[model samples]
Target: MLVSTFHRCFVAVCILLLSACSTGYHGSFVERSFYQGDITGLNLLGPAQAEHCQSYALYLFPLKHSPSTQLAIKQAKRSQPNTVMLADISISDTTHWKIGYAKKCINVTADAYGKPPSTSNG
Candidate 1:
């Protein structure tokens, strides 16, 4: 009985850790926060006016899908996300079976654009 209890606790802890790693960003980012150098020469396929476009991989808990969107916005390294456009989350239900619990993972692709950071003349 003691071993079973310990096993359950271990599984719970593992799940918590995995969930934490997936939520890397929060709120928004400032113009200076992005590595502008990276976006400039990224060779974006389509011609964009002010913002750069990029794709980000997201794994969300279907139920709490909002946070994933925020994370994706940050991934684009955009100071202002004019719109958070995301492709349909893959329609797959397969998950890793662990202790009879299925862990969900789905890819969320996105495209974003915004005004570049301002250069202050301080």
Candidate 2:
């Protein structure tokens, strides 16, 4: 019984460690920018060339529009950091972007998916 329990514990520890390492932000520079009330224009950087800024902008749209429910805003306000480190993994090239006031920070990232539809195609 003791041996079995030890094995379980070891497995749990390994799983936890792997998860912890896998989960977290992987971005270059995270900055805070002014929100001009338009959530669509926020620029985000990532791996892909064209979609990086657009991806981040899309991610931040909800946060700018609905600041009340956003956890990042709350955390930023509570932490009172000029810039908070973000661990978002959905962004392309592992790059992330942010924009907001000192009290709030909106998270944005580059899209990891295929290139955004070209304008000419539309």
Q: TM-score for every candidate vs. truth?
A: 0.28, 0.27
> Model 1: residues >4 Å from true position, as ranges?
27-122
* CA-lDDT, candidates in order: 0.38, 0.35
Q: Per-residue lDDT for 1-122 in model 1, tens only?
A: 99999999999998998677545533232232233343443322222112212222333333333234334334433322433322222121123444533344332333333333458999
lDDT of 2 at 100: 38
Candidate 2 lDDT over 77-101, as tens digits, reads 3332222222232222232334531
In terms of lDDT, the best-performing candidate is 1
C-alpha lDDT of candidate 2 relative to the true structure: 0.35
True-vs-predicted CA distance for residue 2, candidate 1, Å: 0.8
Q: Lowest-scoring 10 consecutive residues by lDDT in candidate 1? A: 44-53
On TM-score, the leading prediction is 1
Indicate the TM-score of model 1: 0.28
Residue 26, model 1: Cα distance from true site in angstroms:
2.1
